[model samples]
Target chain A: MTALYQQSLEGLTRLRGIAGAMVVSADDGLVVAESLMEGIPGDAVAALAASLMRRMGTAVSAAGFTPPSFMHLQAARGALLVVPAGPDILLIAIGDRHINLGLARIEMLQAVEQLG
Target chain B: MRALEPWVEQPLMTFLTESEARLTLLMTSAGQVVAQHGFTRAVDIMSAAALGAAILSSTEEMARVLGVRPFRALSHQGESHGIFLSAFETPRGRWIGLVVYGQDTSLGLVRLFFDRMVDELMAGVPAEGGPKQVLAQNFESELHSSLRALFGR
Candidate 1:
């Protein structure tokens, strides 16, 4: 499982400013596996990403909309992008302020499919 | 910092009374809550207010960078429960509303009535004492007071 995740996210980190990545349990926001570098707090990102995913999932349903295939969070300093990997897991990418989400999103979807 | 006007409250109440929505809250884009319905605890409102504001802000920024339009509404559906967080503008300022519903109502219904509710809200807003352009010198204290009021702390 670790090998699979490691192989899955290796290509994603090559993108500019994406310092870290992880797979987290959407239920409790705990990390399953992570590939991280300095300056990115993986645990906090996992927690927020998991919590946000759970909320977005329900909010989508409550509004009569399709559940989002992915989520992207941007802050002044950095960004965290989340995409559903499976029913209960989320793949999170932590990037710097300049991380390009358009390309990053495409790359993450590929990583998610490859992980499957 | 401001309360939901009585005009706004009437329609919000009516919307809740008519729909199966379990809870609803009107709060600022920055997370300061104005008015709420169906919540008993301050902490719950505080949490909802904070989370709703954060989600709206993040998604709005994400849309700008991703080169897509910002999401007008967000939802999460479980087997029997759901929530909707959406943003609207009023004469006062930008506001975010979060609603909760269960099996008694459907998201389809929620979506339908929510539009009306928003329209009522937008029409009801008054052009007085709207939020300020510059942060107040005592913004910290004001914020704390507002939080205390919102959370009953």
Candidate 2:
């Protein structure tokens, strides 16, 4: 893998209670790199997530609300936390239903800062 | 009205009211107060209703062009977390807003509230056909076209 891919994997590895993580391009809804969940359809998840991200961003923008640099969604079945690595890149983590979302968000934020 | 029936369900309404959280629902298009339970005062419901309307109006526009459905967005402020906006489409093309708020609460409860509320909302509506067909036929193209113009997209 490329250095950027390895770096993202390393960062994702550090987060607690995350079931899987991926670096994705919200611009095209493609997965650039991922860690864990070897057999899962990581690409499809990335695409759907990126689409959701873009839709959410557009929605908030049109509402005259401040556009978010990150978006988080937690459901009864699972939780999804997305952090913007840049305008083009997003770091996404899916967690077990029991994971701590706040902690995961902070960890992802730290990773983003480090990725800079 | 079947559309308004679930709000009055005895156990379900009571569950919402007794939970250690704030809850409210609104009609997206008209921003009308649909149902509210728990500790939410009038101001809170009003604000959430407005927030929901704005978000739904914004997303409905995007969903039209993309042919994609919109989901809920959750925001957190300190220890108080609020999931203030989301869309649930009735079989007749009417959209309802479902919202819930909690303090130091579990993610489980929040999801439960959201699912239950949306399910209730959908249940009250006559399900003569499925959601996919209804959404496909009832695409809010006008909303999308207007938004694209507004946002220069």
Candidate 3:
């Protein structure tokens, strides 16, 4: 289980513009395992990503749409992509603005299925 | 205070009206609001700005530890509405965008125009002048005030 998490995370970072990746708890925002480069702060990502996920859940459920399968945040600097790796775990990816989002989405979905 | 303000206001208002978003806010990376549309209350703006800034700062730290560059945008999709947040740099300074939209618009639509908005904001809008990259004085103190405003403390 640990190896799977580590391997997938390490693999995510190899993608073009992908800087780091990690698996975190959606409920508690704790880091399970991470493949982070020198400057990326995985701990804070894990915590805040989880918190944001919780908040998004509230807004989503209140509105009556399908519970979000995942979430993405876009900015001028780069992109922060999160998807469910498991029932309670979130896969977080940080990439450059130039990163191919289409491919990143495919990679994340595949990783989730494989993890499942 | 910033010459860039006039240029962005019109475009942002247009985006909000055309896109039918509940709210769209533009702010300094330090969480200062430059312009906003579709908000009924000032407190809501203050809350959104603080949260947006907090999330961006934390995510930037996440990027630093990941040894990657930075994550520019973020989003959360609810049932009836969705939130899209992104950070970008301009000649004026680094800024962040926080958007809230309902079923009247989809995330993809907001995104499509948002990218265009950036292009519009940067290239189309001419900067009259204002000591490029100028930012609010005492950002930390201002952030504290925003938090106080948010909590009514």
lDDT of each: 0.76, 0.59, 0.74
State the lDDT of candidate 1 residue by residue for B12-105, as single tens digits: 7767865568888876665556777778876677677767777888999999999999998888888777888899777767777888888665
> Tens digits of per-residue lDDT for model 3 on A1-114?
989988888878889999988888775466788898888876666765666676787799999987777788888998888898778788988888998898888898888787
- i-RMSD of all predictions: 12.5, 11.9, 11.8
lDDT of 2 by residue, A16-71 (tens): 66778888876545678888555555665676567677778889989999867778
Which portions of model 3 miss their true places by more than 4 Å? A1-116, B1-4, B128-137, B140-153
Error of 2 at A57 (Å): 0.4
| Candidate 3 C-alpha lDDT tens digits along B25-102 | 787776656777776666777788878887888999999999998987787888788898998877767778889988
Q: How well does each candidate superpose onto the true structure, as a TM-score?
A: 0.51, 0.41, 0.49
Give the best candidate by TM-score: 1
How much is B62 displaced in model 3, in angstroms? 0.8
Better of 2 and 3 by TM-score: 3
Docking class of 2: incorrect
Backbone clash tally (model 3): 27
Per-chain TM-score of chain A in candidate 3 equals: 0.94
